[model samples]
Every structure is written in C-alpha cells, then in structure tokens.
Target: MTIFHKLVSRFLISPEKKNEIGFCTDLDDILRDDGKVTLKIDGNKITLDLSNLHERRYAACLSTSLRYPQYDIDNLLMAKFVRKGDRILDGGANIGLTALHFLHFGASFVECVEALPWLAERIREIDDIRISVTEAALSKRSDGFVDIAISKTHNQGSTYDSSVIAKFSHIFGDDIKFLTTPTITIDSLTSGPFDIWKLDVEGAEIDVVNGALQSLKDCPPRVIFTEFWDERVHKFASVVSASHPVAYRAGITKDNYQLELLDMKTFEKNSEVFFPISPTYVFLREDCKEI
Candidate 1:
C-alpha cells in the first residue's frame, strides 16, 4: 500500500478519530488501484471493480458516492430511463465517469461530447462497448471556436478555477491561446432519436440546451438532467430544487418541456451540501410516465 493509503488507514483505526476519517483511504484504495469495493446502498449491495482504469479523481468519485447514496453514476445508468440498445448523450463528459457509468448500466450506444482535448484524450483511452468520444463543444451555432478555460486539475472543469483561470489568462496574454477546438451544435452532429440526455456543462447549460433544442423537441428523451445555478435560467424552464445551498438545480421537467413543481424541496443551510449549488432538482418529461 502507498504511504497515503497507510496514513488513511491509521486515521481510520484511531479511536479518537471520527468514523469519516479513514473512509477516504478505503475509497482511495478502490480508486487508485485495481480492487473490488462493495458499497451498500439503499440496503442493497453494489460491487465495483476499478482494475482497468487510471487513478484520477478517485476522491470525487468517493465523495459523490457518499453524498448521493441512491444516485451514483451506476444507479443513474440503471435508471428506468436508460435501457439496452438506447442512445445516450453526455455533454461535458469529463473523464468519462458518467459515460462509463451509463455503459455499466447497459446503454447500447453513448455519444460523449467534450471540448477540452486533454480530457477528451483521457476519455478516448477508455475502450468500452458502443462508446463514441467527440472532442468538440456543443453549442447553438453550427460551427465556431470558443474560449474554453482549461483546468490543470481533473475535477476542476468549470471556468471559475481561480488559479488556472489566472494562469490561462497570463499564458494566453490577451490573445486567444486558451481557445479550444471548434464547437458543433447537437442538431448538426446527431441524426437520430436519443434515449437519455445528461448535461453538466458548468454554467453553459443554457447554451448547450439551446443548441439541442431541435433534438429535444423532436426526439425528447425520457429524462433531461442538467445542472443549473443562476435563477435567471430557471425562468427558461421551471425552477426545480437546487442541488445544494450554492449548487445548481437537479430538477426534473415534464415531456412538454414544462417544469414540474410537485414534490419540490427547499434547501437548509445546516443540511449537508452535496452539489455545489442549492436544491438540485430532477426534471422529468411530462409525457414520460414513471417506470
């Protein structure tokens, strides 16, 4: 075991340390190296093997697993909305975690859209079944280059990474060196119906949605999962609950694209913050009946 793992183990076994102390070490072992880790979620046993993958962002995976006990990437993949032989779209598919999750859940085909070449290359390394990795940003326009502020760290995909943002600006030096490859609208790239659609494009959720308006209207998926932060965007659809106090919406909408307000929950400051935003809502399509 690595020194980090040993340290974590020591913390975990310490009588004075809290129960949460050593948990991350165990998670590190599962993520950094190949091993079988069993997670008891919702009274059910789910086993994961990370033997073939590289060790990056293992902590985020572990944190996400602990935070959303019932809604891990695996659970989201196995969700009723996802099925075998179904086509799924993963926008801002950072490191292919969600894509891998969907693949594990049995998605026949997954189209992963990523803008950054560095992250896209990592996704390309994942050789799995029926997975297509696209290194392009999805926007409303047919084709054009956009400024994509890259993050040095794996988990920091947002444009707000303070250190990276400063470094990027300095490196580019008033020029467009930080600008990434060309971006394409979903309408221009996709040709057929899609089963599931997930968008986690930081703050550009609206632009991505606008780009795929045609597909959403024509071949509306059973579920549309997008991250929303600013309340202004909520006006476009209905304001579902936010994920955390400062996190975006995990809200669900109906088939007609109207926001569903039922079962809405408010956020409390003292409560555990899972997402970086508030009251993450899940939007379900109106036409989609619960499965």
Candidate 2:
C-alpha cells in the first residue's frame, strides 16, 4: 500500500476494526524484531509467528489468525463444505493461509500450489503436517515456466496471461518485469480424489482448471472455489452449466467486509457489481436437493 493508503488506514480506521474487516496494517507497525504479533480475533487473543515471513506476508498471518470471517470467501466456503479427512487442492494458495485453515478444519490433507518460491517457503514454515506446499503454478505445461510480474511492496502477483499482464502493467507501471517460475499441471500434482479445488490464481483461474481436466475427470472435486472475471467468464461459465448443481457466489461487501452469498441468478445480474480480487465463488456438484 502507498503512504497515503497507510495513513488513511491508520487514522480513519481503528486497528481493531481494521483487523476485524481484513484491512491490512502498515507492515512495519505490525512486526517486531521477533517477527510476531499479538492479535485479537473474535475476541480471542492470539500471537502468530511471522519470523521467517516476507514483509508482504504479514497480512496472511493476520488474516489467518482472524480467519477473515467477514472478508475471506474461502473461510465461508470451508465452513459450508469442508469436513474431516477431506483433501483440498489449494491452487494459488498465497502464503498457505487457507491451506492452514483447511487443516484446522480437520481436513486429512491439504496440498497447496504457489507460484512464488518465498510464499511457498512461508507455507511450509507455518506448518509441518497435513499440508504440502509446492512452489509452482498449476498450468497446462508440465515443464513450462510462468513469467510473473511481482509487486515488491504489496501482495499483488501476476502471470503472463493476457488479462493478467495487462492489469499488472496498469498497476505496476509499464516498465515492470517478470520473473520466470516453474509450472506444473494439476493432474501431475495430485494422485487421488480430492474433495475441493480452491483457486485464487488472479486471471489464470481458467487455465489452472483446464489443465486439471484429466484430474477432474478421474476424481472430480465435490466443490470448486473459483475466482473469475469478464476475461475468463466464458471458460468459467462453460464448466458451470445446467444440471451441474446449485451455486453460490461468495464476495465481500462494498467496504470489503461482511461475506455475501449470491445465487447464480443474482450473480449474473450483478456481474458489474464485482471487482477483481474482491470476490471469490463456490460451486458444488451435489444436487440442490441434496446439499
């Protein structure tokens, strides 16, 4: 965030309220020499270790500690669909926050795929069991490499996907450069049936799902949490068709606080209401009458 953004977040919003609403605090103010912070979530005081974390990752520790109930759509999806022994494929698992949450929810195993090496390192540092972190993007090419434009001061990261690169340029300036990262397909990553596939790959959401077709065919996930926008709407809609099942769009309120679930009809009609990185969705294969 910029200096102006930090100031506004500091004076206009109380630290307690900001934590409650999932608003990020200034990086320096939150971390001490020991690289840990004591935070209150749902009135429970907790101290999270961020010792080996990157500056950009402190937000993950904060959100994970609080579970961002009001802002993180994944938190809501897990509450509704995930259960003990369930296996979760957390594609684009930034900092592994949601992956940790899955384990906390009793998931027998959770595999997290992250493109950035440092973020992947943080995931492993956060836990040692019931979770595996891979520092590679899930793509069509098993041996391919993804070029990513990374934001050094913020959590923004993007791949060479047309829409993503465009937005990356717009946000980080035209001269921004990309670092090549290893890539692997989902089919090559997992061996057995998984219960849910959670993706937050910015604009590469469709590509990751497409590459996972073989895996989806062999052992379809009961639930899929996708982040979509106009650029990838067709691919998303194609996978979500008639008779698939009932669906709910999960998003935050205008202020980025308060989770909202919108039915398919409401979602399509209000497409313009969403902005990138602001919402994620949850879809299920179980029949409406069943779930």
Clash list (residue pairs), candidate 2: none
Highest-scoring model, lDDT: 2
Q: Rate the local accuracy (lDDT) of all candidates.
A: 0.53, 0.64
Instruction: Encode model 1's per-residue lDDT on 1-291: one tens digit a residue.
Output: 544344334444457645432323245443444454443322323333444232322433443322232234334334645777778888788767677667666677788888887677767766654668888887767678777765433333444223445544543344333545687777776534667777766566666667767776666666666644446446435322221112223322222222222233343332233322333444556655353
Encode model 2's per-residue lDDT on 1-291: one tens digit a residue.
534234334443455666443333334355343445544333333344545334223444344333233335566568767888899888888766577667767688888988888778867776556778888888876888878877543444566577766755665566776779988888788544678888778787767767877776666777888766554655575664432355677765554454567886686687655533454667667553254
Instruction: Tell me the TM-score of each prediction against the true structure.
Output: 0.63, 0.72
What is the lDDT for 59 in model 2? 44
Clash counts for the predictions, in order? 30, 0
| Candidate that would win on TM-score | 2
Worst 10 residues of 2 by lDDT: 62-71
